[model samples]
Target: MDPYGDTLFNEQAAQVACQEIAALTLRCADDQRKAALLDLAELLEACETTPGSDVLLMGD
Candidate 1:
């Protein structure tokens, strides 16, 4: 989770991230943030199902 670099999560990590994202989405009060989390969760879930695929989080 770097703020100035890139972070990558493999299938196993993506599965865990997806679960955490789902829980965060549920607890989030802001609609915009919740929506973004949901979108990220979807991408993580996709990576979880695709072999060798990873979720690359690019930081600014």
Candidate 2:
């Protein structure tokens, strides 16, 4: 795959993972897991510092 394609695929995967984490947090009744997923979501948001093409896919 080209660099651009690879970036798109990776970004899609990250978005899917974030969605899954959010769903799990809502479905599961574990406070620790919910907290951890919330933390992960925050960290992922912080890590995305660049305002590139992925920004659109990531909801910004």
TM-score of each prediction: 0.87, 0.51
In terms of lDDT, the poorest run of 10 residues in model 1 is 1-10
1-60 in candidate 2: lDDT tens per residue?
Answer: 344433332345556767777878889788888888898766555435433424223321
The runs of at least 3 residues in candidate 2 whose Cα sits more than 4 Å from the true structure, single-residue gaps closed, are 1-10, 47-60
**In candidate 1, which residue pairs get closer than 3 Å at backbone N, Cα or C atoms, i.e. clash?**
none
- Cα-based lDDT at residue 21, candidate 1: 91
Task: Supply the TM-score for candidate 1.
Answer: 0.87
Least accurate 10 contiguous residues by lDDT in model 2: 51-60
Clashing pairs in 2: none
Query: 36, model 2: CA deviation in Å?
Result: 0.5
Deviation in Å, model 1, residue 19 alpha carbon: 0.9
